[model samples]
Target: MYDIVIVGAGPAGATLARLIGSKYKVLLIDKRDMENENPKKIKNKCCGGLLAPDAQKMIAQLGLGIPKDILVNPQLFAVRTLDLNNNLERLYQRFYFNMDRDKFDQWLISIIPNEVDKRLNAYFKSFTEISGGYEISYIYNGQEILAKTKIIVGADGASSKIRKLIAEDISSPEKYISIQEWYECTEYTPYFTAIFDEEISDFYSWVIPKDNYLLLGSALRPREDTWNKYNLLKAKLIKLGFTFENKFKTEGAYINRPKRGSQLYGGKDNIALVGEAAGAISPSSAEGISYALKSSLYLAQSLEEGIDGFLDRYNQRIKGIRLNLLIKNLKSPAMYNPFLRQLAMKSGLQSIR
Candidate 1:
């Protein structure tokens, strides 16, 4: 029996494992094959792959240095905000490190202790409450395997199956379908562009320049016409002189859009949650790496120190993060509200000349 079963190997799971893997018998699991020794298919998040300033701060606090290989071309220095409805464009000074998202995840997994058992291509199936702990079942190579663990941690992303199977009350966040596409770049697009079109998405859409390709992504409401909205966004961006030579690959996933602090929870009882699974992502910007790292770190401190049963301590420690998310929600109207955003753009409050 393992002490803990982490159902994801993302930043949250990897960090938690790195911190407490040596202390406990940890079994880290992920649907993606992130391990180094075995060669298998690769998978990762559908993210913009840009680390915001807050993420940089978390990395600094963790004393983690990003490797050169993880670095991608065209490090972003500014954000180009486009209001398609108002036909207004503004540039704001911002610092973001463009990196390879998959490679970054692999690095996080690589730091995990060797003692920890990692299984890949294993899709979580179900779980049952046993006498002492829980029996977790997952599909490996099309076969089901069972393992017992004292505690289960849901470090999975917005669409965490672990969270769904959780016994305790979980604050549910609004889910959105995020679609990202990589296009072969005809010319260099330097700025990280933020597109706002009510016709496309009430949340938002983005364009980031990766190595030899431009990654265009959107957070749209889940519906039958979701692709229609995405297509609308593309048509609007094209009108703004954006060119796409060819589409290379498209990736999509379910992302959480937490509107209230009450939507955030650190889990309860034997089941614990960290990262986006716990509604730790930003409500305004949708940046998750910083919150993911912070949540996992707090959970680690609670587990590693054996401070009052991990769950209670973990919940208490994450209040600041939840509050931070609420504050971002407060700031959302200024960015998302079309009239307010238009006024702000016209005023050129923080926009670069």
Candidate 2:
């Protein structure tokens, strides 16, 4: 039996595997094939692919260099915040990396140590507790497969299957569907754009420019009027000088916000939920990569202290990070009001200086 079985080979699972795979028998499973070179066949992460400064630091600490092929743009130097209601715009200087989400995920998977049992194209089915461990049922190559592990790390995304099995007592957080569309760009901008308009979306919208393409997306509350709102956003962008072809494709995924007191651990069980599965996403910016990597690091450190107090330690660390980020996002509500947004923007600029 393996020491740990990590589900979903995204940032969290892959980083965890890299950290402890040498010391423990680890099995990293992902539904996507890491060997696949075709971009069209890869899974879409539905991300704007902007890596905040915090995430860049984490990667630097891990001693990993970003592959050139994975990065779509060199670096974003500024952010353009647009107040749609007031027809005002403000620019803030910041440094962030813009990448292709699919390739970035693949790069993370590629760094996992060879000793870690990396299984791609393996679809996780279920988990059942057994003697001294859990039996992980999965489908591989049109056949059923089973693996035994002492601990289960649910590093899956927001809609985690492993979380459904373990976090039965935990209430789910507020969820929104993120819809994104990539378009061929006629002009390039050095700034990433964020737009706020309560009439279009209660959450937020972004326009991120890459090498030759621009990705526009918004997190929208699930409602019957979602399509209407999306169309309205499209029209608003058009008015702001964005053009899209009639035949572009769209991608979507679910993003979960962290609840105030949600459980990060599965009640003293051997299951540890990390990343978006445990609501480690930022409520303000909707950024998740940094949390995914940081939370997994915390989990690895906790597991290093043996199994007895690992769950408690992991929960404490994860919860501390979430609460801090939430508190930092306390200013999010002000973005809905034009006057408050302007004031907040000014305050933010002053603080940065």
Per-candidate Cα lDDT values, in order, are 0.89, 0.82
User: What's the residue-level lDDT of 143 in candidate 2?
Assistant: 93
TM-score of each: 0.96, 0.93
Candidate 2, which ten residues in sequence have the lowest lDDT sum?
A: 259-268
- Report the lDDT tens digits of candidate 1 across residue range 64-161: 99998999989989999999879999999999999999889999988889999999768888889999889999988888999999899999899888
| lDDT (Cα, tens digit) per residue for candidate 2, span 1-353 | 99999999989899999999988999998998866888777767789898899899989888888988888764788888887877767887888888887888888877778899988888999988999989999888899999999999998888998888877778876789998988877686788988898888767899888777788888898874887898899898898887876436798999986546453443348888888888778777888898889988998899888877788888777767857666746756676667888777766653323
Best by lDDT: 1
Query: Which runs of model 1 end up more than 4 angstroms from their true locations?
Result: 36-40, 167-169
Best by TM-score: 1
